[model samples]
Target: MKRGWCFLLLWLLTPAWALAAELTGVRSRADAGNVRLVLDLSAPVKYKIFSLKNPYRLVVDIESTHTSKALSMPTTGMVKSVRAGKQQGGDLRVVFDLSSQVTPTSFLLKPQGAAGDRLVLDLGASTTPVKATTRSAGHQPQSKPKPQRSVVTRSVRDQPQRSVVIVIDPGHGGVDPGARGKNGVREKDVVLGISKELARLINKQPGMRAVLTRSDDRFIELSARRRMASKQHADLFLSIHANSFTNSKVRGSAVYALSQKGASSAAARALADKENAADLLGGVDLRGKPDLIKSVLMDLSQNATQESSLALAEKVLNGLSGVNKIHRNHVQTAGFVVLKSTSVPSVLVETAFISNPGEEKVLGSKKGQRKLASAIFKGVQDFVELDMALRLANAPSRPEISYEVRPGDTLSQVAQRYQVSLSRLRSVNSLRGDRLLVGKKLRIPTVAGI
Candidate 1:
């Protein structure tokens, strides 16, 4: 009787001894702008998820969980690959390598019928929805539900528009401590201080959002910095840096835009060469890319982008003149790798010369940083206002009417009938002469008053 009772007690305690959750399988799917990852487990597990930059990645750590074998899942959307491994104390760790930054959310699903305990992760852009899969698990086979809702919510008439996004980058971080001043002030630290102040001021303004490439002391690749701005759909990309010179006497601030041809001056060429060399220290591999590919990439800077960059640079330079000495009266042009963004208007602002003794003191002080930040913020405000005004002016205020020419209709007759000037009608229709072709459609300009 005693032996039978001891055996029953041992059997009852077996489950308590083996309480670790087992990860069974993993699966992933992706839609237009979002990705969904599901993890099947034997029991509910405590887990945490976080994001890491510098070649963006998402990490999932599950406590008191173990996987019998390596876990692998297909990559989709922003995710480039998935990796799983065991951590200290037998915890399961899964990592997702991503091509771009994403907003991540996770939740645990209770067991229901045939479905076991599961964890689901949703990754997507900020403006897109991620709860589509979570809310309708039973309707996975149907495609109509998600698209109809997405279309309706995205319509301009239904929802309010998003604000303009501005990405600010602080140059030189981590092991690569850019030019140091005599007082032991680092360029990276100074620029970060100024960038943070600028971001703070920008956030207080209405209809403007600010994003920093690196909010902390982390090293980010030059190419990845620009990619971040593009992924965020940024309207403006501003890189903040403290300048240095061989002559410690050089003191002033300057602004630069990307130049397709060459540097604007000899000094600008030397500075560009110096800044471009930072890639080597940051561990950027250019060996895989061919010369032809590099040439093609350089040619991607379109005329419209260049013009906008120069306009922004000029405004920023003008603002800097009020706070500090102007190094170059005009906006300088350089082949800066950071300013090579094809779509977003990009500019590099040299806040002040860190090598100069007097300027270094100002760059390192909090009050001076605030002043510099205010100047840059004012410049951005000016640029945004001017850009908005230009867009409004270029946009058609009234609807244009198309009129088909009749057998006896003349250009002046049509203009008179439409209550518009003949010259305005000719210009709107791109007419070279007074003659009008029959059966041809002419666009009539809607003049307020004739």
Candidate 2:
């Protein structure tokens, strides 16, 4: 009763401008082509934006507002630093120091579910892509004929087969640091390290390449991450994140595929809520934000894609189980915003628990991080092999090679030597086990490779 009376007195005595508006949160997101800065406020207000040169800076001034001391000041991607302070004339001033010149755009967003009013500012690279500077003396660069056969001919024959593209996203960047461990192990940094390692492994594998949604410690909206994967024509969209909880004892790896229905369990629902709240923290209001969400029409094509995502999630979960303790023996189902691609098969992987002291140490080390990455790569490789086998079964018969099993050779070794999936090799040879007797003849499928 005493605390309540004090609060009432304070509220009554406070100035209207200070009580009516507040600069509650400030965060930034690095998009594929630009960076977005959002200011969370208690109420909407008229704002002003201006630019500065000489080392490049952007200044935002909001009239009649107070700010939270905990308001985030992000330094990621090209953003050098951010600072918020009171301006003369009783205005709130937020300044962004930039690494280079950038164009700024601003918008006002009304309150959304579980979120309040926000002011959004977008920064784009001021310097555009440079074109060819040197030109031939005779003329500008001439266009080659479509059917040209010259050495410089732009043709499919000159292009090697495109490798399978896998887009790896390191979750919770920019303003959202994700869950923090007792020892200050940040989920964003740890997952970025793991994602980079996984990309390296994936690139080293023959006939595969990797693209990272974010290559540095920065924030990216979930929608932007998904759009990037789709734009790259990715075969797989694998989002990497580290889990955390109040109970440090809860720890392990988990895999999730998006569910059309509600989450499979209560915990899954709660986890989804935490993840979906990322946009709010980053200052992105999903309500009336059409640019972030393209469409919600789940057609037959999307259904087929979701099915494939689930199958791949299962394979990845199996692979994760081999390297680390499985949080769930089966692939969990959740409505993760990151896994909402209409064409790409997507999954979210919780590499480990950052909140757990033991797991945090393991994830902090390079060796342990690589081990986790390798485990994820194995799962992805399995999914790719299974997908290829399905395609091969439907594809017209390709030429086959026959080889006799050499002495001391195992089926797994043979599969590796031929650069083919173990499952496909087993299917073609009709082998039930890894054991192979000497001099056994096998029909090798050339579908995976020649």
Candidate 3:
């Protein structure tokens, strides 16, 4: 963490374009289950949106905005999913399309700090045959199906769409204080607070849900975290952590991916070792399993998912840069144990440095945490939007990378063969060990660390 003065100075030096821009409208539509966003801004806003290979998500960045009203988000026809709010002091959005072909509508309302202005929209109802989209214009169409709501005559599964499940992992809790600041603030607490906030925001949206790896203050094995996401059949995973440095003069946010074997830094490998060690805390044995097999599988899996993850990570990095300095402008890849969930796209977010006294105090503050969490939420939304756009525009799905299960194939051996870390392989394929079933299929996650 850097001094308060540095933050102040950075703010002073920021390009005037970023400081004064404001978000106005962001309308979305669904076409064949794909969602497309058209942002109506007061001015030409310069922004970027991409995905991170780890903790896969879509991220968006905009100059700034003062949203003071309830935003109009439709859940009707083409719009089967929607999420919108403030993040990092800017307008945040999250949306899911049951199919492509969406129509967008937008309007603005006056400012009201607490409730904000009312941006009203009616998502005409999806053209798909889902029960929720069957309502006629005679009645106010329900945005989505809530717990208390009744199911229409149509069955949800009949619509034929994949559910998107997101798992949130809050870093450093219980016995691990993680990084501690001179002001006595703990990184664990700050990240937990932000995670909870993000979960709350995600839960409020339709077609999206969140699960926390550890809901309470307790220690959890890193392997278990990945397993949790696998058990939940999650679509994405996110690990949250606060950073620290020997000198209390550095501050910024960062995101990381899994490293390819021989491509990871020594520091990243060490961190991976520590994180993987958490699995041993639960007493998982590893006396010579198929390490190479697991590695090969991850390489194949990542071949299909890496592009999206990288895009999302880049978007997040850009979005975070809008709110604060970035530890690294590019997305980094390492052998992080927590990110070893092979099925779900995963990423680790280092929110800020706790070693800096000023940053520590700010992070401990409710306002600071809220701001940080908001930025992240918005970045995720942006990533989602980009994905929807690609789908609607007929963008190609990632090509699946494949690996063969050879006789006597071990996880480590396979990993070494593919030049990917063993943990990374296990994560992508949801493998318990180096054990391989002959003639089985596997998805490899990474070819090298970036």
Candidate 4:
């Protein structure tokens, strides 16, 4: 009689101990452009993550974990399908079968009020090519040919290749030193170093390639940069730059994407105007012509590509948050003329503010450059995984569900209701203004904000 009572008591007490487990830090995202998993735990908790060969399923096991809160599997942003349940002995496990490949950015958030220690995971897009800068001596800078290359090339039937082309634009080259610091660090030099380091890292990754607008100290026109990407059929474009201000106290890195309508932020429009004026300094003809119409259409196409750009920017931003101060919580979008390429997903990363004396010293150092490069590389890796996940999710069929605009549906409010950032809402809807008036309609992209 005593032995039977003791056994029942032990079994009941085991679950209570398991329920007390607290999750500490979580630090893993897709690495090596492959669908990988990373997890940082608070204690020596038993867990396993592995893929099964037969039907391509990944299983994750966690010992002694139970919750009244529902266990939600990763959704179809960067994931195809997911299922979670408790196995025998009351252990927690999750199984995922990807249609293609999936890279997950996962972390654990501690209990706040009602919730217990929770895990958060972000799914990212497929990997594209890394941005590279080419310094070929014989590479010719050509004028726009009379017979323009076809904008759309149908190559779906061709064999898939690993090599991906990327264009890297080092902002403020030549006479344009961009933002200057009293501490003797030039914004142009800082950005160049980071860009070179990033290029080196990207090139090291297999099936990736990068090109630079200006290889040396020479100046390259903004228009020429876009032309170069189009000529090479570049998959992605990234422009590296450093920020500066009158006050040296401001610090942190910022990522910028192209904005089609309203400025990504108040400061973005100013930067765009300054960058667009670079051609004036180089004495390029800006007079009215029929070719300019094509340029306008190209700008519209750039808007469409912002989706990919935002994915890249978010991954990079998430990585940078670990090392440096994040300038903005979310990726910033703006009317950057340099990012106005139709087919390519383009972004401008303000690595740090050069005006700060401490940051200036760090930017000039080799170690700082490498750190920045590594963070950026991680961001790129995350982007690739997420991109692949998205492709796999959408491969089968399009999702259904639409939203008709209601009165007082401000961009911020709609974004909040949908649990997305305001910038994303604007990007998808092509809203010209941040303040939405009554009677406008917008499409909700995802089933839910994953």
Candidate 5:
């Protein structure tokens, strides 16, 4: 981790003229099973709204506009708080913090008698059919302190660490279908299908395990994706995507590394521009971020990360060229949001062009998806093994043992039985609760060189 991470490369301020419309006022009305929020605008505009789960939130994004200072956000009728902000490229981002799951419907109304143009939103809890998978709102997970006991360990030499961890991100999901093809192929679905295959192959390797940013079709903000990768301290972050173009004739597989100097090619620039809008399409609040920006650390990390990214891009490109048509003989560069991990070396792979009719058919088929997955799996495994082989040569190999809990045994007792710290057991296995379920298998970590 780099020090002095106070500088964050975020959106810059826009000028006055760029702020096109004036947000005049906001009002609301309430009734049983329904609540309406009306925003008076100086002009009619285009807008979109989407709901996010795992802490239910409703987000609204409007066209070029400025927020109204006099606009009052009412917390009545299932609304928690309404936060409005200026987004990059002269757009207005409004986020409604919700108390529970609510179906949101928004539409524009023409100026009527005694009223200006209005963007009316209806958020009704009862009208929305709650899904079984919805996590309870404000449900805080409790982690009890484990009972303490003495833990003994057999003396051993330096222990080798765990396998190299990779984070795989299948771009755009849920409401954001990503780029769509004429044949009904969706970018989100295609990438996800390929990513799942890659994960299976990576896990089969001796020293590699892959963690997905999202295991299912769900929306995860670009910021949260990188945050998850950093939290895991992943060795690499690979984002799988399908390319698209308005022309519909362009088709090929390409690999990209991040570039602070802008895009290397016009197509790369356009694709990055489209992909960067994913947060907006997915209804993510731009203002949600860390408190401090670390400029010096960010710069240092970017330089190193880009270097490693370029190397992986080269290797991956080679593997991909054999399986698919090469978009560019050399790796390309772009500002991909999901590839912006400071600590992890990241690369974004454009498997093929979804906009191209012929390529779309190939990518949509299971055979095509598996071929792409196998190419990516081989590339990543080759690169990671070579990189870590020298480092692991001197370290003792870590052998994970699975222990099934018996009756009358606590998690602490299990840790003691394995001569490992309780925290180590939990961290390695991603345990949340201290409660032990008999016959549940727990992966025990070795203490020699952990």
Candidate 6:
């Protein structure tokens, strides 16, 4: 009886992490000089990978994971052979013998549709011999090779600026096919077509890149769409959607920014409620999402971000005016879940009322989609240029020294004494006249490093 009690105590004291995750299967695909290996998992697991020299092998160690007996290995391409063994402390180690020295890239993907959690590893042949290096899961191994200098030289002023990333989201898909028109045109189909065209146009411009939340007909949660924009460090977030009304006569385009203090109008409030219900229709549970409410509250304090969003909405509204009838001449505000991003300026563009037969036909046609995409692109271009100008104007330059004017001091004298241009000094101080009043502060700009 005492031995039985002791066994029970030992079992109860064991840690929950002692339970292992199962590595269900292994699959591989081979190309000309590269090989891709996919490991199917019953649950997500922590992993580490490293290269081995002198026989050239790659080792992968997954923590608290056990390999299934049916797991298979590949024998072709960069990988010559594969072996699996148990490591200390309930870890599984898989080693790959390579035919040649290779660089490895890896990433973990969450479960989607019929697939489970997956760990993907890609091995590519390297020209030079590789040094053994260790890396955590989903990270590329760092190379020790020194960077080479460019053959051509250029001035610092000639360097290109960083590209602005814009995240485009097409609303509703899959089971939740948004609004439908009399002609059988679905909102999902129309907005996706327009979003793709917008992405194409934005990519063609210099110093701008576009990323889509969903390129296909997949339903993404409203909060997830905003999170995607934040993940991309996006400068702007545009949610493309087609509006619908109970009355088929209502037809026009509209732009909206998020407002924490209720909607601007009754129609805007109803639309926001309809849009927010998409999560429930798409089977997304919002019960445990306190972060969503927190994000909305946080956005309320972000006045600069809200102002930028309003400015962006105005520009997009102006652009829409050129393509179709304006639903509202001014930009509207509502409590849209997708526009609650705290950092990125976000807006939702109602392309047109899908319920209207006349606009539905235009939305379904290729020519109409292109025209709308072009208008939105033009608006985005205008906003980006204006934003860039404001940033440049506000950017810190050469330091300035505060000088109080004396009885006989002149503006030109201060400019000359500081070795700064008189015009630049006048511009910096916003002085319309050159006369300096005694006892008044004068900002004298100084050259950097002088």
lDDT tens digits, residues 202-280, model 2? 8687666677888776778878887777655566889998888889999899988888688989988888888877888
Model 6, 280-319: lDDT tens digits are: 8888766568676575444544777787788788889989
**Candidate 2 pairs with clashing backbones:** 173-219, 174-218, 174-219
Q: Residue-wise lDDT of candidate 4 within 286-386, one digit each (tens)? A: 43443753564464444346667777788788888888998788988777766775466778898888888878877888899889878987887555533
TM-score of 3: 0.51
lDDT: the better of candidates 3 and 5 = 5
The alpha-carbon root-mean-square deviation between model 5 and the true structure, to one decimal in Å, is 25.7
lDDT of 3 by residue, 1-450 (tens): 579989999999996546654455556655654444544444333333322221222234333544334546576344444334443335344333433322222233333344332333322333433222122112222343122123222222233233345678898677766778888888778988988888777656544556777766777766567766765556667888887878799888888766655324564555555544544445554324447326524451354466556556766676678777887778887767566555445778878878877778768988888888778877776665445333422322223357788778877866644334688888889998778998877775421121
lDDT of 2: 0.72
Against the unseen true structure, what C-alpha lDDT does each candidate score? 0.74, 0.72, 0.57, 0.60, 0.71, 0.75
The reply for model 4, stretches above 4 Å from the true place, is 1-160, 285-304, 389-450
Candidate 5 lDDT by residue in tens digits, 328-447: 899999877677645657899999999999989988999899999999987896567433333443554545667788999999877643445788888887889798888999887532
**Highest lDDT model number:** 6
Task: List candidate 2 segments past 4 Å from native.
Answer: 1-161, 287-301, 389-450
Which stretches in model 1 have alpha-carbon errors above 4 Å?
1-161, 287-300, 389-450
Tell me how far the alpha carbon of residue 382 in candidate 1 is from the true structure, in angstroms, after superposition: 0.2
The better candidate by TM-score, 2 or 5, is 5
TM for every model, in the order presented, reads: 0.51, 0.51, 0.51, 0.53, 0.53, 0.52
Candidate 2, position 171, lDDT: 91
Backbone clash numbers for all candidates listed: 0, 3, 80, 18, 8, 0
Report the C-alpha lDDT of model 1 over 1-450, residue by residue, as the tens digit. 999999999888876316788888888899888998888988877775555443466667787787777777666888888767555455677778888766676666767789888877777765442221112222222222232233111111112233456799999898778889999999999999999999889867655667788877878877778777765556789999999998999999999998979999998888887777676787875445446226535353677778778878888998999999998899999888777754667899999999999999999999999999999998997676434322422333435467899999888777644445688888877888999888999886442321
What lDDT score goes with residue 157 in model 1?
13
